[model samples]
Target: MLKSMRENVKSLKWVLWLVVAAFVVSIFFIWGASGKLTGDDAGNTLAVIGRKKISGDDYLQALRNRIEAIKSQYQEIDRAFIEQLNLPQQVLEQLVEQTLLVEQARAMRLRASDEELRDRITSIPGLQQNGKFVGYEMYKRVLQYNHINLSEFEHSLRQDIVLDKMIRLLTAGLAVTPDEVWSDYQKASDSAGIDLLILETSKVSLDEAPSAAEVQAFFEARKGAYLIPEKREGLAVFLKAEDLKKEIELSEKDIENYYQANLSRFTNPESVRVGRIWLPFEGKDKALVEAEGRRVLERLGAGGDFAALARELSKDAKASGGGDYGFYDWQSLPQPERDEIHRLTSGQTSDLIAEADGLAVIRVTEKTAATTTPLAGASAQIRSILLDEKARQLADTRIAKIEKEAKSARSLETALRKAGLKGESTGLLKNGEAWSDNDPSGAVGTALFGLKEKEVSAPVYTYTGVGLVELRKVEAPRPAAFEEVKADVETALVNERKMETSRARLAALGRRLEEKNWEDIAARNGFEFKTVEAHKRDQYIAIVGESKTADDLAFTLPLNEASAPFDFETGTAVLRVRDRKTVTREEFENVKETQTAQILNQKKNMFLQAYLAKLKQEKGIQIKYDKFLQLTQDVLSRYESAKQ
Candidate 1:
């Protein structure tokens, strides 16, 4: 799931990149988080050191526009690179960090006015053709086409400027010293040597056990390494628009009123009444399922119950319900389903229907006459519709109130009563079917997962439109108490015992071999003793790369020497190191470029982490990391809900 999320993040980034690239691409879905354009769109802001809202919409669009620019520059651009260029996370992080830095600059009384923002944007080397700032008309046109206005556009461009300034200062002192680089280079080329005397601990296990003192000491030494988790106390309230609709009481009078006022929404559509028959095929011969559909179709054509035939032969979800799908119009069934139905009349059943999953059988149950529904006729439905609308409005208002109430309540019981709702509590639960999709009580186990002792949840909408809910409390996560984890702990102990037994046996073998040699030990142990050739680091069977085993162990052996058997966690193995050698200069140079690039990247990343840490400290840049993460979560949650 985490891997998929990473991929999704990558995909989001690319989406921005693609939009930035082609002027021809009209993007609305991304700006709406995979939906049509919406109101909860994001915003952007630039500050000299104060809080300002940034537009999510502007940020997403600029991200898309950046891709367009890249594509225009490189005609052969691919989807992968565009995705890397458009990380929403990177954009958000950049937005927050830049906001912080700019705020710092502002706190010190820094000011970049309208003129500076414009000059900065236009002065971009990529944007300018002739030295002078690009024409505002051209800039305005691009921004307009990308679904943004002047101010939002300026906000993003200014953020880029603040980032450039802050980064330059923070990273100003970093350099790759010649001495350090040379030392790294020499180490990369060097080989380490070491020797070992194997003592196989696994060869013994009497659970003749550790003395009580030893066991107690082992547990005590590791006591502080374990811990409990932090729990939260919070309040939340959700106003589901759907739930609000349920309480809406629409009277006949109200329906009539609504129909009179909004007459268009109630008008009936041109519709077809239909039924079906299904058939299956097996090679060139008659297939069982299709044969059934054929038999039913034949019976229908020769005067039979269409619904009965459908019930017997149609392979559809509606088959058991006598294939009765209520009235449908042009917009009701998609074009394909509608077309098939449109081909039939009230008494007609469709021909042997051939579909990949199975053959289909269709018969028109009844044809709906084309007519305009009068307001009077649609009054009841209109009332229900209007009632739902009213209910939703009420639900929203009450939900907001309830959420506010929860925030200050001393307990869930108090909050629920005040909200005019009910609450239920449950013991700790693992995320599972009963606590997830199939949760019986529903409220306590569904929706956002992390929970603590007295936190409320955002409103969760029940599919039945019963109501929205909030989880009021949860217990903190902790190491399982002794009894709770007894089974697992026992399994671990048993495995340890088995390993000890094996290690002791190996230790005895090693001792005998050191005193007598491999032949006598192998003869008595009923195993073969063999030597492997001196192999390259990359050719090892057990360890990978230039690890301590490959580095220290492999290079230390004298030519043609037999080492004692070693105990690995899973088993015991003995090695006879035949030779030790270094990589020739020619061989090392062959892969030098790739190796150097990896080394540089590793170093750069380490430096960046330290640099950012220093900046946070030396500049006294204090952050409520938890609160900040909360803000990010708040924005994300709001964003997800708006799309829904």
Candidate 2:
């Protein structure tokens, strides 16, 4: 369609008016648009859309209700997402948007009943797992973790349902035909296939500098192109996660399969009791200490307190507390360390054991032999274990054949085909870290990083049970070859030069603008005062009469102050600072009318919230958020813990 439209436009060059008409009709009229406004606290609903009202009472209630809802839904603590709510602007906009959307849903006769509501709520993806609604406990906790009230969330959810239904109704049959699909495919796949010879300044001599007249004309034509963009100068500490958090959305089947596959992790590893004591390698007469420890064990065998003996004589940091080594099962400890500890049982203390730093005395305090851990007993761990198995399964499926075939194959080029595979080759891939070149599961990442050149692992598993993958080839890090990126280097140099020249122009122009030299600068630089009439805040449009740089600089100019030099993407334009005015009532009406619709939506939101609350109150809804949170932790923790 775009290609056809472009072609049509080209063909109708004589009828350019049609293009303008098409834009105006399709974009502004039919689709409709809203402006995000900076507004005053008018203590009013801009407008009510449907039945939901934003009465003064409703507005105040809405604010209080939103706050309480937030308190109910999430941990009252700081997190990145949570911090976003703290922003003054964000909070205000968010509340307003919510009110509008919810009330709008109500106005259209869009609604769900108690049973209908319950059914819809259960189906929400936010609270589903393994193709089933998460337990009531998990559901509540998930809401809390997200820092939202259950009522508010359902209110939000109901609004979404209503909106979704509206969208479906609106967009029904609003689709691209096969012609459209083919059109897209053609434009996307069509090759411009440009191969042109170029001559540059490097090819030209210094004597070939533009003639004075030509230079002036060129400068005049492109003067507005160079300008600085508006900039935010506040200090910002950008949040960058050291490790990408896993974002695994699992299917019910995958979860179930995963649960079935990793049953062992779900069970607590038959709780084993162990105590540890350490002797420093530098301890004087270590052999004597060992002998003494043995004698102490002998005393314990003769009914002495082992913990007391450990505290009195053992040379371990933990000995400070009478060797009351904390309780833990073997699985909780590091594997190599746990393996040694696992051999000991209740009443049996190890002899002077040498591990790393020093000799250690140890005793087993308690033990629980292998027991069948019930589903209820380890649901959290089971969920995670299941998910990991699923990721690994998926990863293995992806790479298993490649891994096996690569061993016997001569080259990756041949093996990839024989295994029916494509290695997602890219230099941008971080070593040992995930790149979204493949499934985004990090399974491919691990396989790629784990391999040593040709070394291959069988269908390797991933943190998510996406499936398995096999390592194929590893590319060693190397600087880019000049031949490979000569064009890129040239482009970079050109861009750099352009930026420098543009900034100089802006700086010079800014001086002229400051001195009321608009006419002189316009004539001298071949520019003019660009006017952008009736543009609302945050509206994206070309500034009429002014260059982009000048417009940007103008926006930055303090009230009654001249703008300094600025640079835009195209070029520099030092804008003469002009008057800034508050948007008129007409502008506010445009916004107010829209906000009124939102107020209507807020009414619906409130109604739904009240509706759900009543249902909970009447039906006696019960939930344990902690249990649910624990379940989420169990399912999600695999991505992090399994790798370790």
Candidate with top TM-score is 1
Q: List the candidates' TM-scores in order.
A: 0.40, 0.24
CA lDDT of 116 in candidate 1? 78
User: What lDDT does each candidate get?
Assistant: 0.48, 0.44
lDDT of 2 at 173: 40
In model 2, the Cα lDDT at residue 36 comes to 16
**In candidate 2, what residue range of length 10 has the lowest lDDT sum?**
233-242
Model 2: lDDT equals 0.44
Q: What ranges in model 2 sit over 4 Å off? A: 1-500, 509-530, 539-562, 577-579, 583-644
| Candidate 2: tens digits of C-alpha lDDT, residues 1-644 | 33533332222321222222332122212111111121133333332323222223333233333433343344232223333564322333343444454444555787756676678756655444457765565556544533446665454444555666754553454333444444333322222111111112222223233444554444455544433322111100111111112434555666555556766544434555566665565746767766765686578778888777777767755677776555532223333345566787777776665543355666778866775446555466555554444444344344445545656773444566775645534233444455443335444455455454444444432222222233443444445444444444445445546656555555554434545435555556544344344333333434222344443444454643545544444444443334554434444444454445444454555665665445334433222212222233343343233211
Those runs of model 1 whose alpha carbons end farther than 4 Å from true positions after fitting are: 1-50, 62-91, 108-162, 173-180, 183-399, 418-420, 426-481, 498-644
